[model samples]
Target: MATTALPAPKSGSAVTVRRILAIIGVGFLVFFAFIEIVPFVLTVANSFKCLPAVQAAPQAFIPLPPFGISCQTETGSVRSATEMTDGIAFNPTTEGYQEVLRQNLGKWFVNTAVFAIWVTVLRLLFDSLAGYALARIKFPGNRLLFFIMLGTMMIPGVVLLIPRFIILKQLGMLNTYQGFILTLAADAFGVFLMKQFFESIPGEIEEAAQVDGASRLTMFFRIVLPMATPALTALAIFSFQGTWNNFMDALIILGGNPDLFNLPLGLALLRGAYGDTLRWHTFLAGSVITTLPLAIIFFVFQRYFVEGVSYSGLKG
Candidate 1:
């Protein structure tokens, strides 16, 4: 019996193949990044345009201010469809921001800030404690409680709105800030994240803390929690962003109380505030304002937002 040996792949061919794959991968990445960022860029640009300009040439993303003259100009106004695709430059205007801010928008801003900040702070404390308890403490029905939490995550939040509204009303918490914060204080995802990360920690650390006569609380706060900075930061970002942009919960819980309305809800109602017309520029302005804080925070902190790596210890 004769057996044939296959030819080995050439080094040049392998290198060519790798280069082609690398180019394709980078191309895909750039394409996706562009698409993701384009909406934000358009929002920022359109927020600075006149309503007519926004509706006329939305693709005109470049803003050109008539320096030392006036923001308003004939070039900025589109009189014909022919001009829509002719150029990308339009005179930038602050009218949208001015009008939106003038409509008692400051109050809505405060409301959104209050809701987002309080909820985020409460969630950090409650979720971390709950996570630590579940991850470390071996109480009766501990696994059962954790499983219940996981189950809750599977339930669509929209489905719970009716029940939540009824509960809040029965407790006289509806249309109240306290009720809003309490309801969102400890979400399951936060608990699950912290628990999984906590489990990754070496048990030897707890033993060492015990050897040093440190109480469980002391060891938890001083040792375990400190190491969980990565998870905590991630949790904080998610909580803050979610609460900041949360609309439905705010709407149902607050129940037409303008004082407690968040930015998202307020912005939605702004369409009707104008009556018989949609103000895209004002909407875009509000959107840009709403999106900026989260975007800035993420970009600045992303360098430090690393996955929680398990500690290797008790070595010889």
Candidate 2:
């Protein structure tokens, strides 16, 4: 005799529930996207707007009219007309950007580039070396040293500004590139990140290299470093971003020297904050310029950045 067939499983409700959840999740994502991207879009838009337009309609995504229209006169002279229209016009101007460029932002860009590049390179080198030693080397006080370095991270960075200033003054490094470059060259977070990453790497790889008669330095530079690309990329991105956007330290150190000012200090100098009047247009233009490098760096190395964070925590 044949047995009765089992009832078919019903998945319609389950599928419907999943679809509902997916729609809700997608809605939340869209909301967050608007929240983050709208400001940048407005900034880019306003950076091309005239000062009057910016001040008149600061919160508007589109600049309100009375737009300036240039017409060639019969004698070959150009005259501007203010057009007030009902609909939104696409009459864009570059006054804010022109103001920023006229302020000699190129020199500030170069100074920022130099400061950020050197800080990132040196931090990566010094932090990676210290991290690798702490992770791989067998020595007395190694743990103590690591703990001391980690403990320093807990102290507020602002608290050290005065002390750092005094030391730089005593050393005659104030208002010098050395002061900014050396101040941020090595940091505790980088050391911690790299050490955790190095710890996650297996010891067998290093041992195998050693067995092949490779020296310690060779093993580290050639063998291990290649494997730590993700961590290094993350560290480089962080270091570059931190150094590039460092406003307070730049203010404290390079504030007195306009010739040595970076983008942050330059932007600060552009602000007109006497009794509530401000220059938002020029400030936003400078901000847009300053944000480009960080955006590029993050977009390029975002993959490694995620992986590095994952591996750093895996062993710790």
Candidate 3:
């Protein structure tokens, strides 16, 4: 039997198809990026604006009068922010920042920072340890335990709120920083994430450490842990951002005490003023402050975040 020869497609047509796909992909990316970024740009712009300016035209981003400079007339009388807020170029003010600072925002800032930092540290240490054990340890029911943990992640976090509240109440940890910290320190997702990353590491390295008379703890801390920086950094970012931005948990735990509120809860408190005088500027200023640290952390260590996510996806 004779087989007919198949002709390959022309190179020019293939190149044209590739170019069209690339252009379409780039267009979609740009469209989505704009959608995601516009809100952030508006938020940042509005944070610098006075209340009237923000309220009058929240979409305005450009500054007419120099930023941090008061809007004024030739007669030297101050102008209402609304006067220039209709246009793209509006007067920018530091009043929002000042008012926020004047509030008990300092205490909230400290509380948020403490919660985020402590939780991140604990998660990195505890999660990595748990993950490493689940990945490498040959104990009985290890897979069972790992699967059980993954099961917890499937349950809605809100479903656990009542139970968590009850547990904290029984432990007399409600409204206490220590209780809140301990409650958030170890989570199933972190364990699973770290476990996945740890499994991707070569076992030969740990064996070499053991052969050199290193204890399991020493080998983990000195050898394996160092190699898992990407995952650790990613975990740190996630833990800190989650803890820092957490409203429901913080509200449930610390709602009884305004003095102990984190930034999110505290910002929510700022909305209680009368309808006409809600202080939108102050609220926006607080929001910006809340987002700044997380943004900075993500920008600084974003490379590691990507690597950690990629490493965690690798299956043995």
What is candidate 1's TM-score against the reference?
A: 0.82
Q: What stretches of model 3 exceed 4 Å from their correct place?
A: 1-29, 57-59, 64-67, 70-78, 82-86, 272-277, 307-316
Higher-scoring candidate on lDDT, 1 or 2: 2
Screening candidate 2 with a backbone cut-off below 3 angstroms (N, C-alpha, C), the clashing residue pairs are none
TM-score list, all predictions: 0.82, 0.81, 0.83
Candidate 3, 1-316: lDDT as tens digits: 0111346545777767766877898899999999999988888888887666776644789866555765455677655666657667776788778889888898999999999899999988999999999999899999999999888888997887899899999999999998789999998888988887787778997888788899999888988888987778778877888999999888888988888899999888667643556777777888899889889988898887676656556632
Model 2 regions lying over 4 Å from their true place: 1-29, 56-86, 272-276, 306-316
Query: Residue 196 lDDT in model 1?
Result: 77
Q: How many pairs in model 2 have backbone atoms within 3 A of each other, for residues 3 or more apart or on separate chains, i.e. clashes?
A: 0
For candidate 3, what is the TM-score?
0.83
The candidates, ranked best first by lDDT, are 3, 2, 1
Off by over 4 Å in 1: 1-30, 67-86, 303-316
Minimum summed lDDT over a 10-residue window in model 2 is located at 78-87
Clashes of each: 0, 0, 0
Evaluation by TM-score, superior candidate among 2 and 3? 3
